[model samples]
Target: LAKTTQPISMDSYEGQEVNITCSHNNIATNDYITWYQQFPSQGPRFIIQGYKTKVTNEVASLFIPADRKSSTLSLPRVSLSDTAVYYCLVGDALANQAGTALIFGKGTTLSVSS
Candidate 1:
């Protein structure tokens, strides 16, 4: 398993941008970071992946440095409803059709307010 680290919590206001950073010190070269958002009593929803320099989706944008040791999840214009627990999981990016093992961190709780 990879050694991952993240903040315990974060605070943001409505319509503001929020960025959560995760660090994976033992990440492999082929490993990519996948961000997930989980609301209370809900399952995790995929945000984006940082396989290369960056990856973006409708939900969020992920940025990865060249060393692939860490990733940042950026959420633009967040609202109160956007408050949730975010997770970063690292896994093999080349294992397209194979079952890959993911290394999960504790998670970061994001609090959004109006």
Candidate 2:
């Protein structure tokens, strides 16, 4: 995966919007980003953030700029249960081609309060 930088922590309240960004300066032209949300004692949730496709799910929306060097995961009206560590990793498409496993670095912790 390409080197990425994300905020160490963020805060939000219920009914408020939350946006977490990640920066990957050296990303390839064809690279795709896959986001993951992990809560304590639970596995990471998958979110496909592709450059070609616009993905908008009930949980969140993934936005990538034209340069593909940065991305933001937008969570609309989150609740307390939404608190988790969000991660963005580059080269997910590459991993699928090579059958490689995912390696997650320290992600941004989102704390949602009432």
TM-score of each: 0.89, 0.90
Q: Weakest 10 consecutive residues, lDDT, candidate 1?
A: 96-105
- What is candidate 1's lDDT per residue for 1-114, written digit by digit as tens? 567788989999999999999998898777778888889999888778767798888888888888888889999999999999999888776776776655557799999988
lDDT of each: 0.85, 0.85
The CA-based lDDT of model 2 is what? 0.85
